[model samples]
Target: MCEQHRTDSALERHGAERSGQPRSCKPAEARRAVERAVTERCRATHTHCDPEALGDALLVASELTTNAILHGGGVTDFRVEVVAAGVRVSVSDRSDRLPVARDPADLRRRQRVGGHGWPIVCRLARDVRVSELPTGGKCITAVVALD
Candidate 1:
């Protein structure tokens, strides 16, 4: 199986919060961790989230995590928080390369290998933001609607 499927399987067995430490080993692991956290938090808070929205949240998490790994120099520390309005997934990485959405036209012209992640994130996430970390690197955050 692929790394992402492996991580997802592991998350199925484990509870939401694994070690409370950021997972940087793989993008799939990071994405699964965020998804698990969001699922558990939604259950705990009794938030009304549809399956499609939850799937979108997971997709956004995966995209952001992949962006962080491929462009932001891997993951450092990350957190997923569930608020009243929605879920927030934040990933911190060692690089300060702020993510940007590639123009669709440019993508079609250049035929980039992997420039669609950020744009997918923009569509799936209700809000997206990035901030420089105090110690080092940067954090990319995405907020997904709860319901």
Candidate 2:
């Protein structure tokens, strides 16, 4: 129901590109980009974008950008686009370490705190990818279904 991002030029297209250090690219900014794209781009082409799906897309963007800043040493680059399949959000960060998904209940069945972002992204997005950048870092791309 979603398409994976095909090229790296998307960050350039959105004009939210950053590298090494985050210039305060907050989660709200990324959500706004997704909202704008889904509203303008889909409306321009007369394509249908499901509201629920848009919400999922925005959450994915938030989780990615937030994770970048909190864990990956800030957001290096950000991109959002409304494709035919759905909305695509890509976030680049300064860490090459892949995001690890921890079970909510560990071996002792103890409930964890504040580690739900990765799981939320995985559940909401139809396509998720992690690619190491050539300049040192990693980019995570997620696509949410519009229908």
Candidate 3:
């Protein structure tokens, strides 16, 4: 099994790791790695996640990683874990700026075209959360349901 698969198995069995948890990689490369990891993990665990949902997972991961690099200062690390209910993706960056959802009206009116990534992620993800990383950064996590 690949390292990603091992990490997923560990997470499913033990919840989050105690330390040195998230696997680190470059933001661009990590996005694709996370998508594949999530897909394989879901398949191995007998969860049914369609291509669309998997695509959404990939897109959200890309957006979050992009945000971390562009606005959140840079990517510190990220984790992709398979849970009993769904898969969770967390990306940590060196900024504390909380991600915000853009107004739907603005999105529809094309008043703002650039800041819709977080809102789109919120809409596609089953659950979204943000927390302060102890190592001087912020972590944004999104859960994508297997159902």
Q: Give the candidate number with the greatest lDDT.
A: 2
- Order of quality (lDDT): 2, 3, 1
Candidate 2: where is the Cα deviation over 4 Å?
Answer: 1-22
Ranking by TM-score: 2, 3, 1
The global C-alpha lDDT for each of the candidates, from Candidate 1 onward, is 0.69, 0.80, 0.72
Better of 2 and 3 by TM-score: 2
By TM-score, the best candidate is 2
Q: lDDT at 70 for candidate 3?
A: 79
**Against the hidden reference, what TM-scores do the models get?**
0.73, 0.81, 0.75
Candidate 1 lDDT for residue 38? 62
Please give the lDDT score at residue 88 for candidate 2. 78
Q: Per-residue lDDT tens digits of candidate 1, residues 44-116?
A: 5566557888788778877776777788788786666666557777777899777777665653476555688
> For residues 1-147, what per-residue lDDT tens digits would candidate 2 score against the true structure?
011222233444665433343455788888887787777766665767678888998899999999998999988788776665677788999999999998898789999887899999999999999999999999999989878
For each of the candidates, give the backbone clash count.
Answer: 0, 1, 0
The local lDDT score (0 to 100) that residue 48 gets in candidate 1 is 59
Per-residue lDDT of candidate 3, residues 1-147 (tens digit): 013423457666678453555544565575566667766776676766677877777777888888888788877777776665566787888998898865755635756558788888888899999999787889999987756
